[model samples]
Target: MQVGGKSQTTWQPLGWTGASGGGRVGERRWRLVDVAASAGISTQQVRNYLADGLLPPAGRTPSGYRMFTERHVRALAVARRMAEGHGWARTREVLAAVHRGELPAALAALDAGHAELDRERAEIARVLGAFETVLDSPAAAVPRRDARIGVVAAQVGVRTSQLRLWEQRGLLRPHRQRGTGYRVYDVAEWRAAQVVALLRRGGYPFDIITAVLDELRSTGRPDRVRAELARREQDLHARSLRRLRGSAALSDYLAETVPAGTH
Candidate 1:
């Protein structure tokens, strides 16, 4: 990347002519195979990137062979790093900005993505802190076995429809009384309801909650909370690292390309 308005480095494209190599002996073009090898990625992966419009199209020789350059290699490296960091959709945004010659917009997109990650990590930490506070608080007295849906819903501070939706998603299953057919929540169900409520408040996805609940039911593990939160922390840390590397690559690309465009 550039420093103090001066371009730091530029990569020059080179041509090789060898009959045993990817292209014809007299050809000086960089072949697709050569580009893939240089980039340390699969040929199919490069093609997939081209299909995704992440990489610009290659120049074509008279025989219709794809020809790449050092610039293409640099672009591919940046795209790969972005994919590793920000995922497909976010990567596409940054790539599109760069493609349109919007370097600042690309940097802004990276900033936004990382900011979202920071918010999510902070939310997870707050949830964990709240959960610990809940554990330390004295337990409320047990309710009657015939506790109705409305009562449970009020206690959990969620709407009745939300509780029903959770049940519809197979997350909760309160018993239906025989005569009135009203939903009934027992002690065990109340505990499950509390767990679901806390998790939902923490913005956990349905599938993750379902999986954790299933594991809890099958294994009776008391360490599920610690295990799940620990895994989430590790995942966020890894993502942060990816974002850092991706930003570096994008900055380098912008630095090398911007000065050339100015001239």
Candidate 2:
């Protein structure tokens, strides 16, 4: 078949035999341009596949134009299939394997790797879904500022005195209303309070904590915040692992001394 001035070949069934016209079984041939167009990829990509040894060499027409045989089309289709079914990263590996005559093994490896990635992605998605559910619940409501210092402290599971100390140290600045003669904290202040609580829990001194918060507030860049948080998380994770190992060692020591049936 030809469409839009490009010659195309209908992919015959697997066992199709040409009608005694000297063509091989399932041998519907097409021009390179047509195959590239039908494949929905650039002609350069097809050429790259051929150059990269993913596809077999193309035959030439009488006028010197490049023509593709049924086998070439099949190879291109396989490459496209791999690229679509798996990701580009794995597709390159699979294509290299195909070139090296280990296609079956490559495909099996791709399947296993894809299955593992899918499992991991599903687990992550499940955790995210659960987090979203909790976030949507009424118990997770975001509190408004200006209610009371104690209210903010209670909401964040911190003491009012700690919050006041943070405020005095310039780590947090709540809104002050002249008419009401009261300091009311908004969401930003609440977030600052949470940061201060985390820093205090992490054993950071009040002076260092104040400086960090000051720099963060002055910059207000999400990237800086993300990098800082990532570092903190890594440090906390390492500390927690060390604590867990220590606890396990203590438990083992106790198990060795105490009788198994002790009350």
Candidate 3:
């Protein structure tokens, strides 16, 4: 990042190899405006990053002005990537730890985020499996065309109170019959209820069952439901890759900045 005319005030490599064993490199002192322009953020935001410990402390000039350097710029770049991948809260943790020269703590925070992603992936797999288990179960028909609460309870083999509880838990949203004020279940609601019943029978908790019902309601077809879950799986994979990239960048930065035999 350079400090000059508009054309010069953009991002250019301040010379980071993104590789290990290059300790305390890049001696160029950057300007605040140049750093802000290069990162496409405001000067105030850069200051906020400093205040929030998202970046290492900037050096100070003899005149008491903040001294921006190539190291600060590289750290900002890494923080941006980590924020995208590990999320802001964990990003703050990693950045703060790294600035403190506690590389192990920074790595530990990243590992924790990856562990969370793993748990989410596993939960999605379980939900998909549960969906398959209850896919073949028949939805009990309403006696008449009315698809009211008791009718659905009888057909789904659930108590009326249980249905009401599901409604309370936001698992169901049946419409009310005008003037009679009774809950009315439409064809789609009947389908959702069927899903809830089978998952409940399989002993899944409300949260996991919620995932299956959400996909089923939104997609309205078995193939579409499967596709949506697959898309979620792909998203998890993408996030995992992003986190890996962030971790690599941080490792490279630490190796370059920390003096030999100090870390």
Candidate 4:
């Protein structure tokens, strides 16, 4: 539906608004709501994107009504998809490249994002390997039940704060010594601490470590840790694939539509 000068209070599907009164693809024009409806976003969101130099500027009607075309719709669509895995800032750079008709730059931005995710996946693998190796070792079977926090930290090469943070987050449950109430790391707890430290060094968030540790403690299976990492790996892999597909789609759009200009 077309709203010439007034803002739309409710959203509706876009309909063709005549700018040249022609049915041809290049001759047709759309209102702001029409573009918003076509893109499945609110008019305010489109305005915000426009202000951020995300959307191409709309042409003005004789009486100052904003006019849009299919090009704008396509731009918004690509912007939304690019924002999914790559953050808004990165998406902005990518979309800017696309809107300026720089397909290579846009695709390069996508490739860079994919490469970063690849590095992240490799790191996850390394961390999971460390966790599994520690779990499988005979040395892990020995109980250093009375080991203090400092000793455990020193042995594992972690800070006391790291251990305390892990314990606070429910990733570890080191026993407290009687009277003194100091933390005492048993064999199992120390192993868990090692796992946490390795994962942290490899860039796993504390919450994810907590969940993986909980699964390990409940199932007593070291493989559960690998399973969690595998799930994350699959998720990142899927997201990377989607970003590539979006890049292809954006390339197609850039090929067809001319960019407004450099922002």
* Per-model TM against the reference: 0.65, 0.39, 0.76, 0.62
Q: Model 3: clashing residue pairs?
A: none
**Best-to-worst lDDT order:** 3, 1, 4, 2
Model 2 per-residue lDDT tens digits across residues 171-227:
889887679767778777776676667656656566656655664676576456446
**TM-score between candidate 3 and the true structure:** 0.76
Pick the lDDT winner: 3
Candidate 4's C-alpha runs over 4 A off are 1-26, 85-87, 100-108, 148-183, 192-221, 258-263
RMSD (Cα, Å) of model 1: 8.4
* Ranking of all predicted structures according to TM-score, beginning with the best and ending with the worst: 3, 1, 4, 2
Question: How many angstroms is residue 38 displaced in model 2 relative to the true structure, after the best TM-score fit?
Answer: 5.7
Candidate 1, 128-157: lDDT as tens digits: 665554455455555766588898888887
Query: Model 3 over residues 38-99: C-alpha lDDT tens digits?
Result: 79999999988888778776766677777777778988998898888888899999888776
Q: For candidate 2, give the lDDT.
A: 0.58
lDDT of all predictions? 0.71, 0.58, 0.79, 0.70
Please tell me which model should have the higher lDDT, number 2 or number 3: 3
Worst 10 residues of 1 by lDDT: 11-20
lDDT of 3 at 7: 43
Off by over 4 Å in 1: 1-29, 40-44, 61-65, 143-173, 192-222, 260-263
